[model samples]
Target: MRPMNNAPLDTDRPNSLIIAPQWIGDAVMTEPLLRRLHARGERLTVGALPWVAPVYRAMPQVAEVIEFPFAHGGLQFRERRAIAKRVEGRFETAYVLPNSLKSALLPFLASIPRRVGYFGEARVGLLTHRLKNPKSKPPMVAFYSALSGESGFDADRPQLKFSDQDISAALARQGLPVSGYYVFAPGAEFGPAKRWPAKHFAELAASLDLPVLLLGSGKEAELCDEIVLLSNTANNAKCLSLAGKTSLTEALCLIAASRACISNDSGLMHVAAALGVRQVAIFGSSSPLHTPPLSDQASVLWLKNDASYQSPLDCAPCFERICPLGHTRCLNDISAQRVRDLL
Candidate 1:
């Protein structure tokens, strides 16, 4: 974890200001990176957004968490500048994770000695250790882990460590079956376009011989309820709707207990990858190549434009919410049968 010269990082002399990733999911994805940074020394602090503070509130890897009070993608030079002023004398190196040019300005303004990040918007001189974004990133876990200059990992391998007590606690909370149960995550926050058909989820539940737990945020509450209600079972007892129930950290514990996670390409899906839980990730209106799950057990199902849905729109890869065309062909055309086949 030595920065070139192997000198001790200085909080009193010069500390490291590490800019965190945006979104809980992205921040979760970068955990390995944080661990590597932590190994470097004990004086590293994270510069993160106010909303996403919960993601790393208790990470053993972070010494201090610096809150940046401003909307993501908004101009908060005042806020950023203020933070820069506060961290001015401490940071010797800054690791900027987000690709935004503005994300780099803080450490630069703080006048940190060395800045480390990908070479984006041509901030060559600003960052001292400009890592060339790898040509072939292994898996999600190892991808960011390279920042530590020691990426010994397997892309197909899932690798997050937790305590035995935590595992037992999570399973106990889940009410362990005589036999283990399957898990379903039926919603994607990026948009409804990423969601599978609700009735199809119910059908999937019915098809499974084991018990099920459905999980997601309150945003996916209706979708979860629909899945539970639509299941035409004797008691719908097989499916336990855990959606909107667990906190993100709690959900991580549960996903660790799951045998497999069937999900849309969403934060939970990324969580599956990080946890190295077996995953069946379905993709539509998006390219798997750009955002493929970085796990060997992580399988992806994406739609290629066929005659029925020719023309992958100019805005097709726009990654926008509420498709402008309103057709939702990307997801609508996807069938439950496809998901079943993967499962």
Candidate 2:
């Protein structure tokens, strides 16, 4: 057994800080690492951006979640230093998840005794223990799991928990019944190259007897509205665009209580998988081999893997925000019926 700093391994549960990833999918994938840390008797506190903080709440292992008010892109040095003062001497070790030097700066500013993370972004001085970044991108779950400094958790599936009361409240607020509706998360934060066509989503919605609820951020509300308009006018399917309305916790609750969820290779796709909800994840510019939904109930659809798919996607898994070739047949070629059949 590994000793907890200066304490006996069996009795003392050392205080530990975890610097969480900004994206919801990446945050969800870090659950295995958190779980392992908890099992080894480490009390965990997660520091995360406001957008991703709710994800840590779903994890039973997290002792606390501190929401950071940092904006995207720029390094907020003064803000980090201020926040670091509040957390100083509270944690013995800090696990920095994102490779950016800014992400590692907080723990260093807090004067955390030991900081652990992957080597990248000229942060050699920031982290006390650094793992070499893999030359090739590995599965996201495995990539995060390796942060635990332990092996053999590569195949572990991420899991999240929510009380029935919470789920019921969300359903009541949304006027949805348990298992009476299907969730369609048609937006991808990455870009158009990763999203399945809105028309295909509309077609699938029109085919379903149950109501299809489209969920996403405010930025994606317009896209969801397009699906609703198309499904209603073209095929008279009952589709509601609830994209910008719900809170992240409400969204998680809704997904947990739904019959099933269908989504692009995005954050909500991982949320559904972590919640153990039946989900069909559509992959486009990205490869499932790298960031697949880590759930047995998840059925991934990637045309790149289909030998029967005509004009083999030799250019697929480009990992691009938009198709460099301008066509994006990778997502366009996957028929609505194919997705409907999986559901």
Candidate 3:
């Protein structure tokens, strides 16, 4: 965690503390909002969960990235208050990205005059300024950009920047040459409904001419190992599972330097898109309309929109962690050949 701004607030220039989302993809989606804030001469400091802190670090507009020592579920009132005390008068405003009531507590407890976010959960009183929550899901980029009190951002795209020298150093540590290998992120934090099968990923790896590196969090190590094992059995395909081995920073560097990236609708998919890498993003249970990769280099493969798919996926975009119908045809029907053909 980076040190807090203990040296009193600099009131000359406005500074805002951002309460970032826990999910990696959602953190990436918030970049456009940060950019807008910085453009207006606001010094930005992002308070992010440890897992998603690296995403904020990659954004040039962010002045500092403070990893919050908080966990999933519950309020953690004592923890929030303690951290809030340290940053009490540091920010003029606080942007609570997540809609949960607890996400707004720190800003409120710190006495930030302007606490902005969507009006959702029981956080109505926690936020000083709130926009009524939308009736339906909107594009994530546009959803986040609205916090800046700006309109006509429906067509905006989020972007991330990394130093070329830093990327080269990270790749050298991994013994990978730039653009020499392909990246495959097969794990979706959501659940199996969003994942492309291990066997399917192995088949795609086996068909590719270059080496494939499997990337994900420690929780997904076993899943990625399954892909590596399956690929090895198929004509000795070159597949390496570096899921738990590399840090998120290293993974971002790898994705930035890859020949191309292939992923399910996972966080790394958005990372690849923000880095402006050529990528083929596969969508299963989720709709591409709500959270499509906002990059020109991205090619999304969602069967929900395909006309030739047998018995169109009407049950798609269910957004469930697991398929309720027992059969995950939405993902199962998407073959390895189809994904490989896109690349």
Candidate 4:
């Protein structure tokens, strides 16, 4: 799917284009920097952001995606110069994962020789190979796998492929019953201090007896129909919201046929930690050492305010979307039996 129009820069194999990450959990942590640039053979494409372009079209180390029509944080500039004149000469290298000088203005207006990224805002001459923004906040899959020059913080975790007839036609179009369920994801598009209390996810879906879907976006479908009416008023469990009724590749094929997902450090908790599933992930106002969930089979709770569940608020992770000490005691003292004893 690579033709966005200026097609002719294939120069024998080492391609790359990237420029993704306009959220959906930083484009699922740029899939271990597109699996370290497709394990060094480098053919990836990306540019995304039509709501994260189906997460780089379900990434098989991306060969092509390109949507980027611009709007979120809109600078427009003749619509990013008509998407840099339709990707001017296909791509030699661009990378640039959102530090926003309009995300390095379309690989410095598509001359794309070697753009690369990370010198935020002022974007000094729009990056010819910038780097240097790391003074500590790491783990965003080792901050995009250290922009693929790699050097080990251990990478590979965001995987995603899907198709068993698209997870059985998205669980028979969300009538959802293909497997024993449990997928919560209680909404946090970076606000409400990385949200966690939808009545503590409706009392941990009425103490987990299974069948619980939830998921998000259509502005979290009235907070997932108020956690499916507060987990069906105490326990007839089958709680289902299917928020905004599916589609981000059918919510990654219903979090790849969930058996466990819980979530809240959003983007379907990094797509249920890239479908290795069994996640838990909560965190508050964000910080699992800067975006954790590269899944060691996932399980992080991190409520901050000096962890053992609340009472220190020296602004716990105060990355602040709304809790300017508005007492989101780091996500209201994190309990629901400490997320149902990590299930």
Best by lDDT: 3
CA displacement after TM-score superposition, residue 94 of candidate 4 (Å) = 1.2
Per-residue error at 310 for model 1, in Å?
Answer: 11
User: Looking at candidate 3, what is the lDDT of residue 26?
Assistant: 94
Q: Report residue 242 deviation for candidate 4 (angstroms).
A: 12
Model 3 spans with C-alpha error above 4 angstroms: 5-8, 235-237
lDDT of 1: 0.70
lDDT leaderboard ranking? 3, 2, 4, 1
Task: In angstroms, give how far residue 200 of model 3 lies from its true place.
Answer: 0.8
Clashes of each: 6, 0, 0, 0
Let me know the TM-score candidate 3 reaches against the reference structure. Answer: 0.96
The global C-alpha lDDT for each of the candidates, from Candidate 1 onward, is: 0.70, 0.90, 0.91, 0.79
lDDT of 4 by residue, 152-234 (tens): 75646688777689888888877777768888888887688888889888988888877788878788899889878887988
In model 2, residue pairs whose N, Cα or C atoms come closer than 3 Å (at least 3 residues apart or on different chains), thus clashing, are none
Model 1 quality (TM-score)? 0.73
- 1 versus 2: better TM-score goes to: 2
With candidate 2 superimposed using the best TM-score fit, by how many Å does residue 202's alpha carbon deviate from the native? 0.4
Query: Which pairs of residues collide in model 4?
Result: none
Worst 10 residues of 4 by lDDT: 1-10
**TM per model?**
0.73, 0.95, 0.96, 0.36
